[model samples]
Target: MPWDKDASQCAQFDRVFLVLGNHEFYGISREDGLKAANALEVEPQLLGKLSVLNQSRVDINRRVTIIGCTLWSYIPKEYQLWVRMKVADLSRINDWTVENHNTEHLQDVQWLQQEIHNISLEEDRRDLIIVTHHAPSATKTVDPKHKSNPWGSAFCSDLLESQVKSWRGSKIIHHWIFGHTHWNTKFRQHGMIISSNQLGYDSRGSRAPRFFNYWFPQSGQDFVITKTAKV
Candidate 1:
């Protein structure tokens, strides 16, 4: 699917990284789904320009390193059963049980923590930018209307409270960009810039506002990242 004309457009860049999301596993076995997703990195049509970041890191330059993963959320215990039965992921992704989901989430969290710890020990540390498919924090990510809804737990994790809070004064990590809630937002939290810029659903009635056009101009120019912070 990554070789599709629209997706292959990413080849225009010297390097492109993709973080597989939940939907990427839909309609396939977990193992097969991962194989398919990884296939994108080697897609010949893209001239080997794409890198699928699965609990991995890539140094973009001497100053920046991006760590990326699906980073699946930790569904609240009360909502776990509801999510298992009601969410389309369980019904569609073959061999993917709620237990599997929980296991992957834990693994991803551990991998991220270890990666950060390794970086912290390095004599020359690069500015870390985490890119996750799932929202790292639930705060201001869930729709205000669904803030009290148990289902909101499916969209984001408590990484902000559980992990990021511990790095409040750390200077190694600078930004965390994520998506899943489909809410476009940018805010500073725990000494880092957290942002989500998503196209979301195409329908006019979609709850997530459609601001992709503004963020990504139709003029074919690359969007600029003007938001900066002193690390």
Candidate 2:
């Protein structure tokens, strides 16, 4: 697959951190998602296949502590995927088979809630990075040109406002990076830098991968850099 080639392009970096988006689980059975989550329960080492294995408030490096999950989305009703559960739909359609993608959205928020609270208790450490596939709240979405729509909720989280209001103001996370929106974003809010540098699939053709570079433990002198490679 193209990603195999794409993955190699990232070798220059010291480490790669990731969280699956809803797209990663698309066409995957809910049972498979559960199984994948369970496999980590039995053997956490395998999580390297999914990411750096630092999802659970683990110290990712001397410079950064990371916690992340593929967050769920409460899309606006107008933006939701068309629901279809007709007679063969269950077998043929992937949307219905997503198995409560929206419901899991809140669970992801709670995870951040608890993890951030736990990190707040830490003595002294590197800054934090909050990773999710979906924008936690509308502010994270941040597209004014994006037309106002009641149904566009599919892009960002619904419960994020309720949970993250306190966390954002705390200035605990230095950077928040996510995917799924397919925007090349870099915005600052509440003393945190949120980025969504999507290596997106172009409607006309395949787009290249983009990189965001930063120092391992400390960033200064324009530490963050972006590079793109065409395969």
Candidate 3:
């Protein structure tokens, strides 16, 4: 696998973090996919630099903390049946039932809430960067084409209004990074930056210029995030 070879190259980095995506569960049982993700943490080639975030938190320093999970989309009650029948996740991922998916979403949400609450209570609160494979906001992240599609719920959750809005203007969260929509988006909401940098699949034989540009900011340069000083 490309990742097996790529893991060795991570030795040069001080740290590398990853969160499983829905595609990772494809062609395998959810249990097995999780096992594979967890195994990467101990891979010898990674030299302990790699950490797979699964409903977990990692403290980078006194000033920053990262919490991440593969937040599967929260399928709405009305779209539940349609999504189950129409979404490829159910058919391709072995043992992935709608019930299981919904349950996992709830668990991920609960975990995130608890982690944020605990961090907010700390005497010295650290800025948070919440990472998830699925976009956290449905209205904000959904592709325009999918906006009216019922199955669109399979791509994002309405966390922006349901939970994040209650964060009191994103006082603790510095940014949110997500990718699943395969569409690039960056916007500010409630005092926090929400963004996605996705290199979407090539259509037929050609790739979208915008996506290619975002992936190589030095060239087309749609948006760029730089580190001004060492942490």
Q: Write down the TM-score of every candidate.
A: 0.83, 0.66, 0.84
In the range 138-222, model 1's lDDT, one tens digit per residue, is 8886556556766666678888877766742345778888877756678888768888766555334434234533322221222
Ranking by TM-score: 3, 1, 2
Model 2 alpha-carbon drift over 4 Å, by segment: 1-12, 33-55, 76-99, 140-142, 158-162, 203-231
Residue pairs in clash, model 3: none
The parts of candidate 1 lying over 4 Å away from their true place are: 1-5, 123-125, 167-170, 205-231
Candidate 1: global Cα-lDDT? 0.72
Candidate 1 has which clashing residue pairs, if any?
Answer: none
Off by over 4 Å in 3: 167-170, 204-231
Question: Lowest summed-lDDT stretch of 10 residues in model 3?
Answer: 222-231
Q: How would you encode candidate 3's per-residue C-alpha lDDT over 1-231 as one tens digit per residue?
A: 135767876776788888888878889989988888888789876778998999988998888888899998878789988898767899989988888888999999888887887887783367888999988987667556557878778878888877876853257887888877766777888777888766545332345465434433332123334422112
Q: Pick the candidate with the highest lDDT.
A: 3
RMSD of each predicted structure: 5.4, 8.8, 4.7
**Candidate structures ordered by lDDT, highest first:** 3, 1, 2
Lowest summed lDDT window (length 10), candidate 2: 211-220
Instruction: Judge candidate 3 at residue 197 and give its lDDT.
Output: 68
